[model samples]
Target: MTRILPLLLLILTALAAAQTVEQEQQPIPAEPEIAEASAEEVLDIPPGDISPLAGVDLTAPGDITVMDHPDDSGDRLIVSFSPGSEAEYADLFAAYIIYRRPAGGSDEEWTNVGVMPVGEGTQFVDGYDPDFPVNIGESYEYRVSALYLDETEVMGEPVIAQEVASGQWFHQGKVRVLVACLIFLGLIFYFFSRARMGATMYLRPIAGIEAIDEAIGRATEMGKPILYVPGLSDISDVATIASLTILGRVARKVAEYQTSLIVPNRDPIVYTVAEEAVKQAYLEAGRPDSYDPNSVFFLTQSQFAFVAGVNGIMMREKPATNFYLGMFWAESLILAETGSLSGAIQIAGTDAVTQLPFFITTCDYTLIGEELYAASAYLSREPMQMGSIKGLDSCKAILMVFITAGALMSIMDLLAGTQTLSWLKNIVTTQIVD
Candidate 1:
């Protein structure tokens, strides 16, 4: 019995030794190797012929073509593919994801740039990121993959392309505008050339322009100052520019008569321009010493506030003449009324149609519409300016003839039930846009 017990113990010890040897020979996995295997399990592509499970469809999109985007800054690529029988595969896709890989880049470096909904469009414009702007000479490869409802994706073949953005000298869209500008400029230059050749261009005398010299002379005779309001607008306005030009003439006249000329401006820029113009006029009139630096000064930018200040000047200074020439708005009436009440000879001109009535009512002489624009050329009477005005008048006469002909033709067609004037009317009135 004792012998049997020792045999059993020996057998147990052998079994323990065998188990220890087996454990020692089996290698323990390294942490990095385990992690690599786990990553592979997640990222590994499924078999090409794997059957789709449940709602997932394993069908991939057809091949795609890549090209540089036309009429764009070469930073974009146009990816196109045939939708390929929507009836057969439309239900299989939820969306198409566009993937891009840099030239010489690996599969791991591929980027998902855009996603388009199923049945939305077969083409995609891959605009590069502004932060990572496209390299002008760099090549790229793109792929389109179909995504299924069950989170499976089937990828199509890759397309290789490059970017090369170039600019156009003239855009097709602005051709009409360019042509119109050229014609207008041509007319101006032609008139200017004629004026330089000593051709007499007659302008109908404007009452307001004629009254300017009288107003300045009256102010000098009465021993009172002359007030000029160069509108409430800035120098950017066309009316203000015309007003400044006239101010040069008015300033020269005031200098000649040795009368005080007070020009109050609402814009700082206009104040600077008015000051320079008045100074130049004084110099040209041989009365530089008579020019006052404070004559042209900025009042206030506020509309109503500027009116009150100008009105205060009229009441206190008792200026003999007040000239309101330029662009005006609500303050036009207020200024003209204040000058009228002060017993000043008020001469106002403006392109503002709404303010014309107020000026005509409150002032002795008013230049309306085109007359305001014509005031500068008339007062200066520079040959170039005069020629331009004559050319403009000629154009106006031509336009009037066209208008009359068109109106007569339309009236005849309507009354006589004839289509004889249809072509003329269309030519005169129709507008085509592309």
Candidate 2:
């Protein structure tokens, strides 16, 4: 036993030594991306002589730990952080903390939690409500930043905090919404998996999506650029994600048709990710050489500014095909109307029930609410995504029947509704169980 123990100890020692050597040999990661200073220093906020932080080191944002707030009592998450910026350890005397959403969400707007005073460490707390009463499955996140704004403008590593499940409420009909959302996302992953295994998905007739090839071809024929607006929102929203997914498909057809594709984005991070998606699409089409980094451009963060920029691009380039895929706001009409005037064939798809009418009037092809979510089913011919769509359809059908039956029973004062409805309603509403 002693002999075997010695041999085991030797093996453990060797593994530890090997790991240590590998870690030391591995180069330290370049600079960490700080939400305050930015990975690209796009903010250009010069470091000031704000004063040295006492005891804490704010040189890099990563030196601090933020709470995960995993408890699921369905409450708002407020995380407080202290700066660890040390004068000797940090580059700048002046310190400030800033943050942004990693995926460029509207809620990700940088908010200054607090300013660091010289000789004192900086501290800040975030109060974020994940709409606990409305969205049970939704996740809320943000990156906390520590800024060392000296003359050189060095940044601390950004600390990210994710709220754990907080017993959020589901959609109005919990079971139905749960099943449908599951089937939708499940299909996306499943179909992509099947595609990886060389299985083809049977994509159905999606009018708007089907016209992508025609639009790209028309743009090529017209010698004008193709405009791809992947929605103004960040990636958190399902609609925005659907738009981005469609963008990959649209970009592929555009690449194959050799048409100029111009993507203008309102969010900086969206611009970055969209660029990657476009580049990948082009690569998939074996036309990586045609992929232009500048094709995916950043407009302004302002809504109108983004509109004006995209409008100008559309009017000037006169793209024969404009693909509007994303969640939109009041700017929807302006873009759609302008594209209509430009004689561009607009293929618009959004989950906004309010704007569906405008798309119908101005767009040649338009996708309705769930249809936007059904895009993977439309584009990829993978059986799983198709099956998911079928599953969701089945779920929605069940929901409609249940809802109808319940309504009819309530109206007719059926026995079930008469005797049990009131009690169940009262119990659920008042959190009482008698």
Steric collisions counted per model: 1, 21
* lDDT at position 234, candidate 1: 89
What does the lDDT read for residue 411 in candidate 2? 62
Kindly list the per-residue Cα lDDT of model 1 for residues 1-434, writing each as its tens digit. Answer: 86899799999999999989888565867667444333223335354534334453445666677776654555777778765333365544568888888866899978888888877788987775664445555688878887755456778877776443343455555565576567667787898999998888878888888888888888989999999999999889999999999899899989988999899999999999999999999999999999999999999999999999999999999999999999999999999999999999999999999999999999999999888889889888899889878877876776677789999988898899988857767655766343
lDDT per prediction?
A: 0.82, 0.69
Model 2 misses residue 75 by how many Å? 8.7
TM-score for predicted model 2 compared with the true structure: 0.54
Off by over 4 Å in 2: 1-204, 414-434
Residue 192, candidate 1: C-alpha displacement in angstroms? 2.0
Among all windows of ten consecutive residues in candidate 2, which has the lowest summed lDDT?
425-434
**Model 2, span 270-317: residue lDDT tens:** 888889889999999999999988899888999998999899888878
Q: By lDDT, who's the top model here?
A: 1
Cα error of candidate 1 at position 298, Å: 0.8
